[model samples]
Target: MKSTARIKQVLVLLVGVIAIGSIGYQLIEKWTLFDSLFMTVTAISSVGFEEVHPLSRAGRWFTIALIVTGRGSLVYGIGALTAFWVEGDLVNLWEKRRMERQIAALRDHIVVCGGGETGRHVARELLRTRRPFICIEIDSTKEEAIRKLGEGMLYIIGDATTSDVLHRARVEVAHGLVACMPSDKDNLFALMSAHELNPTMRIVTRAVAHDAGPKLLKAGAGAVVSMATIGALRLASAMVRPNVVDLLDAMLREPGATRVQEVTVGPAVVGQALSELKLQERTGVIVFALREGATQRHVFNPSQERVLQAGDVLMGCADTEQHAALQRIVTEG
Candidate 1:
């Protein structure tokens, strides 16, 4: 429990004990309640005040015992108060308030539901892309792991499936979310909640089981990745298609030099042919493929007859400078 909560509990118990003792003293000694309460306070505080009246031997002995017990309670209460102030509970309260402020200021960030290996990798990728993001993990150990990544990231220490936790991550304004929790059911629940919170927000989740993919998609996830299946395919590709693996490895390792880019055709390139764009010569980029809606088709060595469509997504290899050029071509020609 928090120090504040512990202190409150201790004070309540002490107050109950004092109340009961004062009422009992009034009944046993035939004194007024006010006088009995006053005596109890004096005994507890060791105030050295005179007694209400003369006492019998039993009452005199009882007074001594009351002094010792009441003093013990008072000492215990003081110790608890000191602990409340010294154990950094105040710091925690302040940090929580600060976290709320940070959440309120966040917009268009990604919410990572787990801080595990996969979630950490996603966070690293998001960081590389310079995207704002927050992490939510129920496990304290995992949260510590995430904190080691950086100080600017906002984190919520709670279950992701809860709406309040999602709210803490600013789901309303978040552009997307990535859920990599261990349980498929929990991920689905979190995805559903996030989607409900922001209907337009993209939700991506990982599934342990192949069957979970459909359920995750049906539950409102924009993308559902099955790690086990993808890992197996990657292993197979590494064995059978070494060149493809090498190309991906090079792109992944070269942060600014070479990257895999997705360029969308806009009004400027709506009616232009691939040759007219002259991207390969102008930007030194290789057009690897074009994804037209759901279906992706390789457009290697595309001819001059290939006209660019408004919504065509070209996946290609380009350097940082070429990426900038490609963005300009797509947006401004």
Candidate 2:
């Protein structure tokens, strides 16, 4: 049975025993309510206090029964209470240990610093993509909120700027790190620590101040995002190109809507012409750009005659089903 249920049962049993003892004293000893209650408490507690008045044979027998039943119930109730407390502690300890072991076993996972607004959004997107990630937040409340946001999310409670905390998140084996702490200084510190720990890992950070962007990039962040700048750009875009903004919004809100995506060219596609692949006709995917693997240059509105090469990244737009077909053709071919 549940510990709570057991506790309630024990309490009920004790109360019933006390009521029975008091009523027995009143009837068998012919005493007043106060005297009977006092006698019953004394007997149950085993205090050895003298009785209020001399007891008859029946009253003495009644007292003996109350003492045995009351004492036994009290001991059992106390024991249950103690077990409940110890069991709760043990369960918490076991869960903590299990979580630590799971974190230690993760690799190629994303590490997110802070569980603030930006960090929460980042985590949500990662979760949608079914990516493994660990979030570090100093505030207990935010940590709990993030955990509630997603059951699979992993988190640690500590300052992200600290090396020990970063190490605990296994930054060295992580595929990337997102620094979205509220303060620019904290984000910068965390970015630098993550970069130092894993130079090859991609580090993306949020800059609270516009001027901090350059400093964060110099500090080893691969990308530094400014919410203010993005919001400003978005505002301008809404005014200047309402139709374009509407299209983008529709893509975001509608399930299976076509959106721009990228796919890397594999060995099988090398030396093949765009016309031969006929991606648009075959998969309903429109290719917009080709990023050359060798020169790292982009060829926008690539021609049908253009020859596909290994290591080239194709940028295109397609619906859910078309996107899957395009991915299979690009990677498999």
Candidate 3:
């Protein structure tokens, strides 16, 4: 039974016993309401308090019965209450219900699988960007730690490889999913389940082995990242191009530092020329690449004469304020 239900049952038993004792004392001893209640309480609690009035033979027998039955019920009820409070079950239940409601209301959110190093980083980035997301961690210990780490982040403690867990996280309404399970097989399974649930969801998975990358892609993953390979490449780049690495690190670590971001061209800018838009001059955002909406082709350092398309995506680098301005200019007009 659920803890709440068990608690309710215990409460009901205690109340029933007390009520019976109170009514029995009133009928057998002809005591007033207050005196009967006081007598019943003292009998059940065994508080060594004297009776409110002298009891007759029938009343004494009834008091004995009340003490025998009510004491056990009262003790059990108190123990149950103490256990529930000490174990944090009530707080967990409340949090679980609140998270369920939030998950049900979420749409176009990201679902992150696993709460390991990579998954935590993904969650933290989403949090920093103020994006909606849910993290699924199978390990209860890790889930608790992740909950403490991300104060307001939504998460579920369940095996991500299972379709039921994914559904619970509302993968059907999610815009994307990131599978960062330690095992490549688990990541592949999660990706396949998510793909089956939401065929259009963009899925990115981590591969422990190089061969797993192709399999993950064939299983409907949009991108398969190999952390080991990336780490090796980054190490090599740090050695060969120290200044470039330093600049990249600075962009990620420093506040207000220029970083690359993507903004989509809205309907208002459909037929405008890149030169006319003048994003560089207005928002200090350098448009480095233009991705065609229909063909999914990218034009690096797009020509000024190129006409902007409604669904085209512009990749540029800018500070926080500049990025916001560019987004407003693209989306608002």
- Cα lDDT tens digits, model 2, 1-333, are 888899999999998998898888888888888898898888888888998899999998998898999999989999999989999899868778988999999999999999988888888767654668999999987866887877756899999999999999999999999999999999988988888899999999998887998899899999988999999999999999999999988766564546677888888888999888889888988899999999999999999899988889998987667777888898776
Q: Which residue runs of candidate 2 sit more than 4 Å off their true CA positions?
A: 4-73, 141-143, 232-261, 274-306, 309-311, 315-332
lDDT of each: 0.83, 0.88, 0.88
| Alpha-carbon RMSD to native, per candidate | 10.7, 4.6, 10.0
The better-scoring model by TM-score among 2 and 3 is: 2
- Listed in order, each prediction's TM-score against the native is 0.65, 0.73, 0.69
Greater-TM-score candidate between 1 and 2: 2
**What's the candidate order when arranged by decreasing TM-score?**
2, 3, 1
What TM-score quantifies how close candidate 1 is to the native fold? Answer: 0.65
Residues 1-333, candidate 1, lDDT per residue (tens digit)?
777887887788679767866886776687788888888888788888898777677667778878777788888889888888877777778877887788889999999999888888888777665668998998887766886776666788899999999987899999999999989989999999999999999999999987999999998998989999899999999999999999888767666556678888888778888788888888888777776643555566556667887678876877666788888987798
TM-score computed on alpha carbons, candidate 3: 0.69
Angstrom error of the Cα, residue 188, model 2: value is 0.8
Tell me the TM-score of model 2.
0.73
**Count of clashes in candidate 3:** 0
Minimum summed lDDT over a 10-residue window in model 1 is located at: 293-302
Give the worst 10-residue stretch by lDDT in candidate 2.
250-259
Query: What lDDT tens digits, residue by residue, belong to model 3 across residues 157-204?
Result: 899999999999999999999999999989989999999999999999
